[model samples]
Target chain A: MATKKFMFLNRKAPYGTVYALESLEVVLIGAAFEQDVSLAFIGDGVYQIAKNQNTDGIGMKNFSPTYKALGDYEVTKLYVEKESLEARGLTLDDLMDLTWEDEDDDYAEKPSIRLVSAAELAAVFDEQDVVLSF
Target chain B: MKYSIMVNEGPYTHQASDTALHFCKAALEAGHEIFRVFFYHDGVNNGTRFTVPPQDDRNIQQEWSKLASAHDIDLVVCIAAAQRRGIMDADEAKRQGIDGNNIAPGFRISGLGQLIEGGIIADRQLVFGD
Candidate 1:
C-alpha cells in the first residue's frame, strides 16, 4: 500500500469527553496501517499532554501518561502550537516525560518533539491523505 | 475527487466548527467535490433548527442552512449522535410527544455507513473535531 500521510488536530481539553481518547486511537490505527502520522495540538488540546496529571480525584484513570508512548507506535511527528504552550505556561519540559527530558537536553542527542506555529502546521494539511481532529 | 468530511465539534462551543466550515468552503473553491459532510459526536448540534442567538450577531444555524441550500451540500447528521443529544426529527418528535422538531432544514439523519461510503468514494476524508 502507498504511504498515506495523516494529520491529527487535537483541540479539546483532555478527560472531559471521550474525543481526545478516540482521536488517539484513530492515530494509532493509522500508524498500525503503516501510514505516516503527524499530530497537531492546539487550544485546550495542550492539556492532553500535561505531565503528572492526576485523575484520581475524578475517579478516572490517568490517560495523559499514555501520550508518552506515541513514539513506540511510530507516531513521532508531534507538533505542538507555540501559542497554546505559551498561553498555558507549558514548556516542552512539561510535556515529555521527566525521564525522557532528563536524558535529552543536549542537541547532539535526539531532539524532543517539534513545536510549530499554527500557520506552518495548517500549511501542511492539504498534503495529508487524511486529517483527523478531536 | 470525492471527499468525506467528519465534524465532531459543536458550533458555538468551539473553533472547530468554524475551521471546518472554512475548509469546506475552500475545498469547494479549489474545485474538489465533497461527497458528504458527516456530523457526529457533538457535531450533531450543528443541525439544530431552534437556535436563536443575539439579534445583533449572525446566527450560526442559519448560516449553516444557507451554506447547504446555496451549495446543495449533503449535510448529514449521525443518527446516534442526534438521538443521544435529544435532537430528533419530525417522526421521532411525534412519537416522543415533543412540541417542536430540532432537526434543521437542509440536513438529514444518516447512518455511519454514509461516513464509510464517503471514505470509499472520496479521494480524501478529513475530520474536524473537539
Candidate 2:
C-alpha cells in the first residue's frame, strides 16, 4: 500500500471551543493508522502549542502537554507560521520543549521550532494525501 | 478522478461553505469528478429551499442551487441532522405534520450510507468542518 501523508491545519482558539482538542484527537487517530502526519498552526490556533498554558482556572484538564507527546506517534513535523508567532510575540521559547530536529545545534538546543511562511505552508498542504483544517 | 466532500457548517454562517466551494471548483478545474457532497450536523441547512437573503446580497441558496444544478452534483443532507434542525422534505413534513416541504431540488435527504458510499467510492473525501 502507498503511504498516505496527512496534514492538519488547526485554526481555532485553544480554550473557547472544543475544536482544538477534538482536532488533536483526530491527529492521534491518524497517527495510529501510521499515516505520515504534520501540523500547521494558523490564526488563533497558535495557542494550541503555546507554553505556560494553565487550564486549571476553568477546571479543565491541561492538554497542551499532550502536544509534547506527539513525537511518540511519529508526528514531529509541527510547523508554525512565522507571521502568526511574531504577531503574538511568541518565539519557540514560548512553547513546550520536545526533541526538535534542527540543522543548527545552537537553535536546536534552545527550542528547535521550525517556522515557515504561510505561502510555504499552503504549498505543503497540496503535497499531502489528506489535508484537514480545524 | 472522483472526489467526495463532507460539509459540516451551516449555510451563510461559517467559512466551511466557502472553503467547500473553493475545493469543489479546484477539483473540477483539475479534471476531477465529484461523486457526492454530504452535509452533516448543521450543514443540513444548506439543503433548505426556503432561504431568503437581503435583495442586495448574493443569495447563498441560489449560489448552491446553480452549482449543483450545473454540475449535476449529488447533494445529500443527513436525514437525522435535518430533522433535528426542522429542515424537512415533503415526506418528512407529512410525517411531522408540518405545513409543507421547504427543501430545494438538486438536494436529497438520505442516511449515513451516502457518506460511507462516497468515502468508499471516491478517490478522496474532502471534509469542510468548523
Candidate 3:
C-alpha cells in the first residue's frame, strides 16, 4: 500500500459542535493505518490543545488528553500556527507538551509539537496529498 | 486525476455542498475519476429524502442523486453521523426499529473508513466546508 501524507486541518473550536471531536476520531483511525499523518492547529483550533482545559462547567467530556496520546499512535507531526496562538493570546507553555519517543534512536523522547508561522503552515498544506479540514 | 470530496456541511444551510457539487461536475468534465464523496457532520443530511425544498429552488438531494447515477460515483454518508441525525438506509432503519428510511438513491451509509480509503486511493482529497 502506498502511504499518503494526510493532513488534518483543525480550525474549529472544541464543543461548539461535533467537528473537533469527530475530526480527532478520524485522526486516530488514520493513525492506525500507518499513514504519514500530520495535524495542523489553526484559528480556534489552537484552543483544542491548550493547557488546563476544564469542561466541567459546560458538562462536556474533556478530550484534551487525547492530544497527548497522539504520540502513541505514531502521529507526532503536530503543527500549530504561530499567528493563531498569538491571536488567541497563547504561547507554547499554554498548551500540552506533546512528545513521542524515537525508537530509531534508542527510544529517546522528543517533542512532537512544532510552532510555525502562517506562511510556513501554508507551505505545509501544499505538501499534503490529502487535506481534511474541520 | 483521481479525486475524493469531503462535504462537511448540509444543503441549504451552507454553500459547502453546492461548491462540492460544482467541483465534482467540473472534475468529471475534465475526465477525472471521483473515488467517493464522503458526507460528514451536517453533510449527512444531504442523504435524507425528507427535505422538501421549495419548488422554485433546486433540490440538492435530487441533484446529488442524479449526479451519482450519471457518473456512478460512490455517494457515502458516514454511518456514525447518519445514525446521530436519524439518517439511515433500509437495513439500518429496520435494525433500529425505525418506521421508515429516508436514504436517497445512489447514497449508501458507511463507516469513516470509507473516507480514509478515499484519501488513500485518490490523487487528491479535497475538503469543502465553511
Instruction: Provide the TM-score of chain B versus the true chain B for each model in turn.
Output: 0.91, 0.93, 0.98
Could you tell me which 10 consecutive residues in candidate 3 chain A have the lowest summed lDDT? Answer: A9-18
* lDDT (C-alpha) at residue B124 in model 1: 81
B1-130: candidate 3 lDDT, tens digit per residue: 9999999899999999999999999999999999999999999999988889999998999899999999999999999989989998999989999999999999999999899989999888899888
User: Which portions of model 2 show Cα errors greater than 4 Å?
Assistant: A100-113, B10-125
- DockQ, every prediction: 0.17, 0.12, 0.72
**Candidate 2, A1-134: lDDT as tens digits:** 33577777888888887668756866776777666778889888888888899987898778888888786676878888988988888887877775544445553533324688989887888887767677
TM-score of 1: 0.57
> Which of candidates 1 and 3 is the stronger one according to lDDT?
3
In model 3, which regions exceed 4 Å deviation?
Answer: none
Cα deviation in Å at residue A57, candidate 2? 2.3
Clash-forming residue pairs, model 3: none
Q: Against the unseen true structure, what C-alpha lDDT does each candidate score?
A: 0.76, 0.78, 0.93
Q: Over the stretch A1-134, how does candidate 1's per-residue lDDT look in tens digits?
A: 55667787888888878778766755666666666788888998988887778888898767776677777666767778988999988888888642223324362334436788878777777677676667
Global Cα lDDT for candidate 3: 0.93
lDDT of 2 by residue, B1-130 (tens): 9999988788778988778877887888888999999887677888888888789876766667777998899988878778878888889889999998878778889876566556556778789887
- Native-interface RMSD of candidate 3: 1.0
Most accurate candidate by DockQ: 3
